[model samples]
Target: MSLAVALEVTPLPLRHPLPTPPPHHVGQPPTAFHNPWPSFHQHSWLDALLTSRRNRDFKPVPPRDQLVKIVRPEWGNGQDGLKATWIGHASFLIETPKQNNNEGGGRGVRILFDPVFSDRTSPVSWAGPKRYTPTPCTLAEVPEVDVVVISHDHYDHMDAETLQPLYERRKGKINFLVPLGNAVRLHGMGIAMEDVTQLDWWEGVQVTVPTAGSVKLTCTPSQHFSGRALWDRMSTLWSSWVLECVNTSTTATAPGPASPLRLFFSGDTGYRYVPSEATEDTVPVCPAFGEIGEEYRPFDLSLLPIGLYSPRHFMSPVHCTPEDAVCLHRDLRSKRSIGMHYGTVRGGISQYFEDVTEPPRRFREACETAGMVWGKELALLNVAETVVVRLDLPRLADLDLEHVRSSKHTKYFGIILDLFDASLKKTLERLRLNTNSFSATLCPSLSLLAQMRKSSAK
Candidate 1:
């Protein structure tokens, strides 16, 4: 009988229901595009930050081990979980830390963030730009998920190809945590709204799944517009999320388990410096910076954008540069951040759209120049990258610089360079040897982009 008692002893904490946030207004969708050239407005700060055509290529930095299943245990069952894999362009398959069965805290579930899996972030594949490199991980390889957090309805962040398929396979079983006005679109795609939990800024739901354990998903504010088409911009809400699972002692000081473990997935956004003027009565504005800024909290893990930002005048207002991404980390007050949405893809859809195609090394340098700790502040991760941050410590300016600088992103700009060269070569071949008109007109734009890519590579 004593042996049996000893064998039954455990340290797994009792996980309880999450404490919900106060009620918030779920405002109507942003239904129109008033910023005629949002990119120009966004790029106003990229004077020295912009990468030139002289450098464009980047090295790939796949994680030492691509599997998070192996890394979660080190994060431990106490207050940490396994690390996660970041598929490029804002899609992540985060592995929650190990959980104790029936306790409501250890449920280690798979999650998808702003899943835009399609080749193009456009309504029609024909017009939008294609992904320069293949997604770090494909939709099929991912497993049945516990949650899907869609920040907004932008084509790049909330793609049809990605969402429709995930919904088809995991809709009923998966809890979809999305923003307001997005339910109409999700339902339009055949998902039941009941299965979907939509929220405005500062709102959240605590999910306790039999297999996945207990987790709290919270919607936070971002300073960017939303839309799948021109007419529908802002009609749908956009947001970032904080997914956390806390409390584990088998027993602790408090009656319930503690909830502090967190992962932040920033959907798609420019930096928060300019403060988006919400003309449409958007909910979720930061009270600290906006009308209600005091209520915001810093994120733990930030999945920030870092690509498609060329022609600064056009892309600034809509996309963040690598340097700007560093600033966002400071803005969000994240503990440890991972960089995305920069080099793996090309972006900037129109006067309205934005993307960051530049590498973050230079941006990191720029941030450091401005007194922000570069390697210590944020970690710029690449396709197929993973990191395990021990939740036990508070690290700000002392991260592994060697680890960060050593991490390399895939070089997608080679294709751009090759394409640019190929087109120029092809055009030259078709033209007469003495002809200058066609050659003169085409070379400048191609040359500038080429040089810019080249400079950025260095």
Candidate 2:
């Protein structure tokens, strides 16, 4: 079978998925995700360099030796757990709890996301945005990384310098998941094709993690462009990922419904359009995030990009502002969200005119504006700081019931559609009359469904 078929490709619902660039481009495919706004023309590098030449206000000082201990995962138990360690920028060491407490079962599966450890996030060693802070730990220091997830082909997100050493340390045992168009890049970097699984938007695959049972990985859409070089801009795809880990067997014959812990990694994204900039012609649509929440609500934890936004006209179309990140947190319906993609590298337009620390401050202000309590509803971790959270697993009965309900769609299909349909004025009006019963009906299952219905009715 072809690689696309092998990867179980599921085309996104986008009217136009990729860009329609000029004719001369050979390597760039039409499958890339497109930005509906006018095509982006990057600012002149010379102008940017000249603008930022002497501006280094509030440049962060490197952190002291406050190190987070890296632990090798013990997979296979049902005891649920979740831990995240921020290395720097978008790099994170995410650990899912083991299902079993048995001595040999293991701790859990460990994953690395957008891991860039090089001194610079550029092609050349001497010139580029130099690292402001040291890596929390070297690639070799990270325990056996069962999976390495790359959001896109940007140098900051996909550093071959880090991947090479990591592959050598793991002896090429790590399964690398990347965007569909990135296989050739990994292959060129000496990573084997068989060891990599490339996916498009909405496509997913299940990989067994030795003693850790199964983890379902889905390559979801991100509203961002990709290309390591200027010439190859938008040639490859960029994406966010959903990693769901289950301690118990996920097979049809498994004795009970397994509670799975979900982690939504918001690779790097920006809003489709700023709410203020949106007009009647553009309804401010970002279908992917809403669909993601519909299918995978109550994410145990989420890592969202909250930086690189400034000079709103140019960056707002590509990089998310702190407010946009807050909107995404609510869209994803995450239990907790953390800010990323800031403070380590300085290349975005913001650095020229805005302080490097502005992103986090904006993030705090946005969260407070939305009535979300910081440190509880969302968090901002320092470099190398690790936070461990125990997840409350969904009941086996709820899991099984959802499956059964989904299978028998005809039974409640009409009512579901009517309740959620904005055009059905009478149906929504009726829903408000019995909020308690409606909420209770979906309480043990899709409680959010009821909440959405009530909110809409109001």
Candidate 3:
């Protein structure tokens, strides 16, 4: 299907405009943008350089043998449960659970986030922050995608080398969702304006996939600056995103009523700023996260950044430490979270101080301290690893009595009876009930017992 014909976009109106104008439009000419919160602080270049030089002794890259294991993705025609594949760094491919299509077949919607597959994250590829770890899979290995979401214009998160070819390969069949001021860049990549949807924070758009069901993508706030070049720092907007499955099919053959899935992507954000001379608790944190949690709490899954936060005084304003990531997980009320934006690349100079493997270790420890289980509640997945969660299951109420009475479904009914018998035994044991006495009381009528015995014999 044509890109325009395959995707339908509907703008979601906000209840009210933000109290303060979005940071990207704070100035009249809008030459630059700024973090709106008062607690955000940006250090001078000289201080950052001096700190980087002082902390050069630590290992910034792991040995080849210690690198994350890469696995080939198995998408299964996108008809499975909700699946997310980590493509290294901040890139992820998220597929919703199977939903019925117009052709009477089942398919799932696929969304790609901030794909950067270039060797170097820089304006020019020859000299910059080269990837210490390689992409889990090549661009060609990635399955067909329906939507591409860009968080910002930062080199590490957004690479022209990746986006251009990705757009071309899809033949502009992909709908691109990006923060405000980013459409111009996609246009330069040969993407048509109609295929791109730019949204400000709090604004959302419902996208209808021609083959699959619909999803809602919302541009949410992030405490970070954006720029690919020195002169144009913060000229574009940066944001996190909330993706929600809206309309899944509820056919009679489906497992049960459609249960929507909600996912949060913390593109790159700081939970709270930490200064060299001050402790973290004394400083104020960006209130956007708390507000986000209140607005969209209880996410089924969340992808949170958890690395490149060394030289805390400088990096804490933009990057989240592993501990900070744990805090964000709680604030967002996520059921499960996976760490990202770490272990993939190290900058030439800027983010070279932190030990390469420290993020996941710290993340585990922090989750433990917060009374959360490591793999159960929050985790750091191996690169290219795929995680799947089933969102719909058959409930007791969903069982059709008439269908169960039919001869074709008698075997299923028998299985259900076996399950009920096992459960009743467990419940009786837990309650310390006398099985014989309970059975006698339950069937007190002798006539009913005789009738049941006669029916069984017959």
In TM-score terms, which candidate is top?
3
Q: Write the per-residue lDDT of candidate 2 for residues 1-458, one digit (tens) a residue.
A: 11111122122333224345522224445545554333223445575565455443444433533222223332212323566778888998877766663233565666889999999988989998887666756666666676789999988899999887776666445678898789888988988887788886767777655544456778887778788876877777788999887565444545554667678998888664442444312335455676576577657678998887765555665677777676667667665688888877777556565556678888888777655557655667667655555533432322110011123221110001111234334322343343234221111112343344445545
Candidate 2 shows a clash count of 12
lDDT of 2 at 47: 50
- List candidate 3 segments past 4 Å from native: 1-5, 28-31, 76-79, 101-104, 251-259, 348-351, 393-458
The Cα error of candidate 3 at residue 37, in Å, is: 1.4
Ranked by TM-score, the better of candidates 1 and 2 is: 2
TM-score of each: 0.63, 0.71, 0.81
**lDDT per model vs. reference:** 0.51, 0.63, 0.71
Judge candidate 1 against the unseen true structure and give its global Cα lDDT, from 0 to 1: 0.51
Model 1 TM-score, all chains together: 0.63
* Model 2 TM-score relative to the real fold: 0.71
Off by over 4 Å in 1: 1-82, 103-107, 250-256, 272-298, 349-357, 370-376, 392-458
Q: Which residue window of length 10 is worst by lDDT in model 3?
A: 396-405
Query: Model 1: per-residue lDDT, tens digit, 340-398?
Result: 76544555532123323225655665455544344444555446555544332222211
